[model samples]
Target: MGDFSALGEKLKATRNKMGLSLSDMSAKTGVSKTMLSQIERSESMPTIATVWKIANGLKIKLETLLDDSSQLYEVKSIDDKLAIKDDDGRMIIHSIFPFSPISGYEVFYGVFKPGCNYSDDNHTNSTTEQLFVTDGELEMIVGQNTYRITAGCSLSFDSSEKHRYINNGDIDANVLIIVNYE
Candidate 1:
């Protein structure tokens, strides 16, 4: 099966394992029931933001929903990595490391165009994020605090609170982000 179909099956199985109905899943994910149903049926492809919401609602790492973890070793080039684009296509996230329940962490390489802002809701409990700015500038807001990180800078914060990444520089902002679920 294709990746999307596999993802749909996984979603359905996860929801079933959680004993959550479509309505219950919708309530938790903030995605409409119809949309969730469509996703589970592989009738619709969810956006990157939608995928994140589902992962958070399910209390699982995003990689758990993206990668087939049964493999012992996997090698992926930039072109082979799973990538998701924002609604406006201003932000792209490349899945650099797959999710492993044993490892309890996932990594992503993100690129944000100038003037792009990607806001995210709180993740599951005890989740934390580490971000390293590789190029340009990034304005990261966690809860009520904002930090400006330039190239070669890194920051870590609790991700169980609302957060936002804003690219205010004229150039694109590139970052390596790692999410840990403790």
Candidate 2:
């Protein structure tokens, strides 16, 4: 079983340790207070974009949300990985980076096991996300429309548009998600 609830609890604790209230986080990240509350309560999972917003707002790195002991070090390969576990202790490999210089944009390799997913949210600036499927399939729901991308396929869209990704396949799915902050 994954422990996403514990991860959420740690996120809440970190937010409190930084002296940031839910309202403050919502204001800073543009995420709704209601949704933030749900995340804290382990009722829902925060999307990658949501996590990025919270990380930037908290003036902390993304890895901090995964593990409290991770330093401000950089990751530069498939071996360097981060996982977000669900309350049931199901591990989801959240992000991956390769050996390269840090640019304004953030890149990630997302691996979604069967029946896993994250919802979409709003963005401040003109953020863009491009995903290339490596294995299995992905069901992307953007606004009221839904699309599927299979292995060897890719898709890109603006972050301002509401979007979500789910793995409806019985096997695992791998995707490289790249986000451009600018």
Candidate 3:
């Protein structure tokens, strides 16, 4: 689970840094003042949609709103990476690159068990994903098209459309995914 209190603190700090009061934030984000207050007080957890709106209103990247401040440079090994698992536990994604507005990109190392399928909704407009397969096979479906990506192969596609990744091979599928935001 995410640390809602930390998120709330970041929101409040960002708003304060911008010299925006609750009313100002509400006006800019089109979110109810009460809701914003609740979120800032850690009494409520904002939905992804609400967060997106807030990020847009603040004119910052979504990652900027969520990322923790770090040193000028950092290194992360496999064990240091944070992994997110799917609800069904058949897919796992390790964040290989920490989110940063300056980089304008996010990277993940994903593992899909045989027969597992991961479906994703459209991302922000003009976002693109480059996927490189390292092991096994992956079936990628983007919009109305489908492509079979084998080991050592790479595929790039606009991620602003619905997509799915299926591991139909007998073994686990390993893929490196890089997402670039426009």
Candidate 4:
């Protein structure tokens, strides 16, 4: 059986390691103590919004919450490492490459499900955004232009432009999106 309980335990441990209490998180994230406790106990799976709140409260990325696997660079089975979400809500599954120098780039992978589009937030820094479509098709809106990206196609554009991704495909669209946080 998949150990979702262990996943909850790991999340709890990460929060405790940061010396944060449930009350502290509640105050910081506005998430109720009871809800957080249930999440920690594996009684409930947190939604994307709830996960965002917890990650922000812990001052970490959303990927950190799902990284219950072994050390970075330790190869594991694809099913063991991939964090999949079926909900149409905004879910960001990330894999931050291990032990890389802090440069201007932050690399990760994302899958925007059909008709799903995240907030059109511009970059916080002067940066470049690149995307390589791996499966299906997606419509990427960069400022005014909407480009149809198909499998094996790639795009690079200014990160400062207000951008959003939509899965124009009938199925989920997978893409590797890299943000150059220069």
- Encode model 4's per-residue lDDT on 119-160: one tens digit a residue: 456577757878898988888888898899998999998988
Taking the tens digit of each residue's C-alpha lDDT, what string does model 1 give over 52-115?
A: 9999877688876777756658677878877899838878999888565445688999998898
Q: What lDDT does the true structure give each of the candidates?
A: 0.85, 0.73, 0.84, 0.72
- In model 1, what lDDT does residue 114 have? 92
Candidate 4 runs further than 4 Å off: 1-73, 76-91, 98-101
Q: In lDDT terms, how accurate is model 3?
A: 0.84
RMSD of each: 10.5, 14.3, 9.1, 11.4
Query: For model 2, what is the error of residue 43's alpha carbon versus the real structure, in angstroms, after optimal superposition?
Result: 56
TM-score of each: 0.59, 0.51, 0.60, 0.51
> What's the CA error at residue 170 for candidate 1, in Å?
1.0
Q: Taking the tens digit of each residue's C-alpha lDDT, what string does model 2 give over 66-106?
A: 65444456546666466665523322545554221124456
Model 1, poorest ten-residue lDDT window?
1-10
Candidate 2 versus the native: TM-score? 0.51
User: Which candidate wins on TM-score?
Assistant: 3
Alpha-carbon runs more than 4 Å astray in model 1: 1-74
Question: Candidate 2's error at 17, in angstroms?
Answer: 34
Clashes of each: 0, 9, 0, 0
Off-target runs (Cα >4 Å) in candidate 3 are 1-75
lDDT of 3 at 34: 96
